[model samples]
Target: MSYGDHGRPVFSSDPFGTVPPGGGFFTPGPPPGYPPQPPPQSGSVNLFATLSVIFAFICAPAGAVLGHLALSRIKRTGERGRTRALVGITVSYLIIVLAVVALLVWLLRPTHTSASVGSSGRSPTSSSTPVDAALLDGTELTRVLNQPFETNAGSSQRGGVYGLREFGTSDERTEKCVGVLHPAASVTYRDSSMRTFAYQQWSRPTGDYAGAVISVDEAVVAFANPEDAQKLLARATEEWKQCNSQRVLASWGTDGKFDSWTIRDVDTTDSIVTATVGYTDAGSGTIRMPTSRALALKGNNVVDVGVVMFRDPTKSADPETSGIDVARAILDKIA
Candidate 1:
């Protein structure tokens, strides 16, 4: 140690052992009582921070633990991964909260099937009740038709259930009247105990676009009991009363032309409803075409018959078809 011109004490040399012309105290390292620190480390991403983000998708709980540890270490050690640690911690905690919420929702959700059971601990039976196959699909059902259908000239379709609106007029009032002419026109058929249905049609093959001169449609609808059949017939009779003198327009086949019908007369009895409908075939020119339909209920079955008889417009009188004969023949077989 030495004294400068100012009378201040100065070290002869720096701790590094080098001195200038003007003596001054110099420190190449920390002052006394201070421990040496490690070199200022370059900013590096924390291993836990990286793992936290990676495990957030694969294992969220593990990621949250790693993120918390990384952030604690970053704060205490003054490392360079503060941003990485914060991002990991934030993302990891957010995923954990979302997972917990989802689990709670699933655990608390309502069960629909359990609520539908009655106090008897039994589920309610389905509305659709299957019936005997022999009613609508048996050979006896087809044999009831009195019309002489040419060999292999008859085509039939049978099903366990049928919709009334699948065919016929769209207008409700007109459809009510049309239901007598066409069994498939009554939309309420499915509401009853209608178990099985069959539709049979026989047409004389004309082998041309002129269409079949005489075609017959017979539909057989079988129910579970005679009372159900009676109810449907009564309901149909009420609708038929409102359908008098209504014109119905409908399409025929794939042809672009349309056919029309005029309900001339509607008659209803205790168990039968009959109607005379005037049909005009768009392809057959402006001519008077007449059709008759009869619907009757007997026992547990209802039979509907439609007969179209096209006569020469030039002739004053022509042979007419009877729908009553066809309907009675089929209804007789129902019992």
Candidate 2:
């Protein structure tokens, strides 16, 4: 279209019926306030999101991992399938909770039956004589130590097993708890009085000598086998003779005064090495206190039976016999 007064023609500015501010146009370009269109992206589906939903049912952990990756890709490269990733994550969490609950139920399940109790309130599994490691318990220990404690020279009531969780009860707790095989290292522990024979020992042994006190009065150390036991027994017996006539300075308390202790020969058997250590006061030149120490090597085991006698030093009674009795009791139980 055109309009004129002096042959000046005005051309139509509209593309169709509307004209943009730029005016002169026949074909329409992009609309106002709208950016130019970008090239079309591939219409292919996101493989990660597809795999995430599929794996969520088969393997929850794999599904959760894939879902996380899918979400990251959607943010960076503008992929689709946000819904699929979310569904996988939700299902994975539910599966995890269900698995944990199943484990708890399996672990805390109750026993359906009870064992028979005898007249002594002991189980039918109890053994009366020659108790093995499987039969070592409070009742068995009580039977072993029930006799008089000869170390005192006067009859003292032999108490129940030492250091058992409950002192006076009867159970097969040790039979199940303690390992039958020997421990690999020295096993020294402090008593309620905060005292130990760790300092009194001449040399540290290859095996532990203290943990057995949990089941018996004697401190027993286990050897690898009977041959090792015999070798230790022979060496210890030889040392007893040399150590008997010598005076060694031994200090254990916080007083910082070491006593000139003399080891007196008591007795030595084919299986035992026993002696008494007498402490002499430097100021008075008299015997103050004496402590008896005993060691017996049985098959695959070494027993330590010690007695501390501070009230008397000149008592005619043989303190060695007490130690012997203790050693014998230990062997009887473990035999």
Candidate 3:
């Protein structure tokens, strides 16, 4: 009767303790039992699904390992995402292996070609002929001046031809020097004094003059003033005379004019010597003049010598301009 005060079932008629048919704890039909099937085993989150997510983000070994673990769990537990995990692991492993092999190949290749060898086994130069020393000697020079003249073989223009008398060559040597000797030509003109004058002009420098000495093969010639030019020309002439006194490779005033001369025994094969001459027109008078001479020398496989002269028409007698005059004088002496 007094259920609240004594230990007794709330409902006397009911055998087991239960909420009254419509009590707050009571719900529809037997607390919604799991459809009369074995009580649903606690469902697990798919490990393979988790692995697939991790593999997609991390990639490579870490992703690969996690994917493998997930696959095993999927096989054991029959997980729903086994296929996804397997794909991720396979892709990540393939990418890593390919990258490593590419890196190794790039690190090892050679960079330049070795020089070619000849059949003889010796250095190519050893088999080449030696340069002749006499080719460099004055004996091979062209007889453009009062001395024997030799052009620079190395400096001469390519495909140039020369006569034996113009240059000398030995079994070991070859003289390939050449030059042109243009004689003076007379030009008739009137001077400021209204007097008819005849001017003679040589096309090239005739003597040792001051200017640059370019390489034939690689010879160099230094020029000086009248005093020095005269001396050098004299020495050159003497050298020529020694070779042949009767023939006198160089001589003065032999070409039918007081200032005219001839160069003998010139080696047309050698490079010619070239020089520039500078001169001023004096008193506005027509005068006979020689052109600047250019000479080139080649020997010992070296061609290096050239001369240029600049003539100042404004300054007739200045020593500064006299350098060209001096050069012309030297040319005259040698001629």
Candidate 4:
């Protein structure tokens, strides 16, 4: 090497000066006996191991799968991130175990009867007193109907505290007819002091009932005083008497269809009113078997019950007796 004008050393030949025998300007090379060093191994992380950690919080099953794959790949390929794979696996399994335990607890829980719950599986509002709990659940209604019964879809209203407007209508006859069909439609439901209103429709063989033979309905309305309950009973009884032997077309009422009902008879007493109704649809002919209905007053609650028979009533499940029996059972509960 020699110094340039700027006082910097300039290379005249290879600096190490260990040249080859070819006599060209020689360049240094690896030592004669040593093998060439292989390219440095890249230290990239295992892909599965990284995925395991990321999926641990999003999807437990995916995390567990990815963790097992990561362990296998790490062992075969000697990649990094074994600790991350183990952590993901442990957390995923813990979450899975906890979920299984929660499901088991819910499935094995006991059924409650004393406390009334709506079809939605929620209790009534806080304003509901024990008296408002008179509405029967699936278990009670099943026994009353003498068959397995289930709640009708969207036909449950529990823990309601409404004013008389709930029963108001421009047509007097229509209102009276509705009151006869359902005691909750009476003028007493319009009372300012009206309390909780519980109503639910129940049916047997609740699956594929398009060709059903019979159906049952039950309702209960609670008032603050027994006088109000009695007044409701009286109004319903009078309405039934007026609607007797009359055919009323269902427009916007509960039926919500173009069906007509012919009230055959109305039986009224001091506290109970029973009726027999013949039903027909605009397209379907009149159903031979009549529908039996009864309303009973017990303390501050009025119980309404109905049974419609599309076919002949069986001796074991007579429509005429089922409504009366159900009404008695509900009234006994209230008393």
Candidate 5:
């Protein structure tokens, strides 16, 4: 039996006012009815948490900040994305550390003779040693090729010149025996007028000027003392490291496609340092020819050789090895 608030007996009744044969009365467990239930509400997603993950790759610091904010918002609002936020934060820190380290290395690295590595070997401290008065030795460079070449088209000579202007990057940015070389600066076309006062110039040999899709030239210039050459080459290995992923305008074309150059391999032995460098089209990622370079200090003289060739992707026949062969020849000649 059930009782109402007025202390009256209560009974369940049909809407039509009919009663069952057995019974229609019911008993209530509580005094008042249960409160009505509320409907479920939707939750909001945290946008900061999502940004954290996206920026992690492109901007680490931003990702870290967004990740932390997202985590905080998630905890407070019970949103999702905890895993994404954490991942973004972790990656951001790692990238930021790498960026800092690279900057420090660039700021602290020795820049004194760094430009001469790519530019000219002539340093104010250098004394044009090793250059023989009678040894144009154009054949010395030609003899380096054990295999067939395009053939030497012609030859060139430069007396009292510090470095070979006829070959190499033609940029003074690597190591500057001279202070005016700028590898980052725009490149200019060199001609006969410029050669008169150029920092580097090499005499041409008989066959051809030795132009190709890729070509490396080697030569030696001695210092007044062996110690100077050794001192200059001390940081050659590190210098090559900076050469990786370098961006430059196409020397052959005005099409505005930049080339990304990289140093693939770097090695050092006593006073010698060698590396293989290659380039790719910055836009299409098309790999171009690669060059191998070796610099060695033989007594009071410094020998440099470079091998240049278009890479044959199908085969492993790298022409850069020719640079090493030429270096060996120079050593034998000096020996």
Candidate 6:
């Protein structure tokens, strides 16, 4: 047979030899071996997973180390995650440091205004002289007692002095009965003339014998005695009326739970009388009497006066005694 173009016969067949060009067809194959295709790539690591890592690392120094590890893993695996974790760690540490510094500053702050005493013995904060309890004596007591009873009869300015004393059980229950004094000015209805030198006394019974007295310008004008005590209400009333009327000041008996009397037309020379009469009834027609008074100085411009008295409820009454003497004595000091 004639060969077409190759040395081998064009139509000849050889199992181990190359086939003729137009012989039954077979295609060329790939190179001997190719690495198996990599398994289909999983999608990039989840973004939420990176955020979770950030949260876990926040405020924790170890969080940064963990975040870095995560990032390295992601890079090797071609995954995307862990970037936020690194940022969280740094921010958390910064916040912690700032908070510590703020707390320290607040704790170290101080409060209070500075003050000092001067060489004159006066504090920069105050200059008032403190009251000396030791200085309170009989004269001072009398002056204090008379202060509240002094009254300015018809003057524009009214002033008075008063005094108080504690008596009886000394318990707080009887404390309200403690002595007190009040003095007021007087007025004449016709002339509208004002007068000073009016005074009053308040006394409450705490024990058995109890009463109060009032005086003006060193004179006893009003008094009250407890029922069943030695003193009589009628007598006391008469005495007050006589005293006030003599001064040309009106006085009368008050029909009320507390005995009250008022005087008018008071002047510097004329005494104004006001008083609270207290009474306690002891059985068997006996009565207790305690009296207090207010007085005004005629020559002195100072006019305010007052007095208060307290008595023990449990005590016995001395019928022979009247608070008139005590009242007169108190008023005498003012005169």
Highest-TM-score candidate: 4
User: Model 6 Cα displacement at 46 (Å)?
Assistant: 6.5
Q: How well is each residue in 243-293 modelled by candidate 3, as lDDT tens digits?
A: 321111221233532221222332212223232222223344222232233
What RMSD value applies to candidate 6?
A: 24.4
Clashes of each: 0, 0, 73, 1, 25, 70
Model 4: lDDT equals: 0.65
In model 6, which range of ten residues has the least summed lDDT? 221-230
Cα miss at 321, model 2 (Å)?
Answer: 1.4
State every prediction's TM-score relative to the real structure: 0.47, 0.36, 0.21, 0.51, 0.41, 0.21
> Please, what is the whole-model Cα lDDT of each candidate in the order they appear?
0.60, 0.48, 0.32, 0.65, 0.52, 0.33
The digit string of per-residue lDDT tens for model 2 on 74-103 reads 766666777888888888878878989998
On lDDT, the stronger of 3 and 4 is 4
* CA RMSD per model (angstroms): 15.4, 18.3, 24.2, 17.9, 22.1, 24.4
Report the error of model 3 at residue 38, Å: 17
lDDT of 1 by residue, 108-205 (tens): 64322555343345533322322222223223323443323432243566666653335445565554554544544446485778877766666544
Highest lDDT scorer: 4
Of the pair 2 and 4, which is ahead by lDDT?
4
Off by over 4 Å in 3: 1-58, 109-335
Which prediction has more favorable TM-score, 1 or 2? 1
Cα deviation of 42 in candidate 4 (Å)?
99
Model 1 lDDT at residue 256: 50
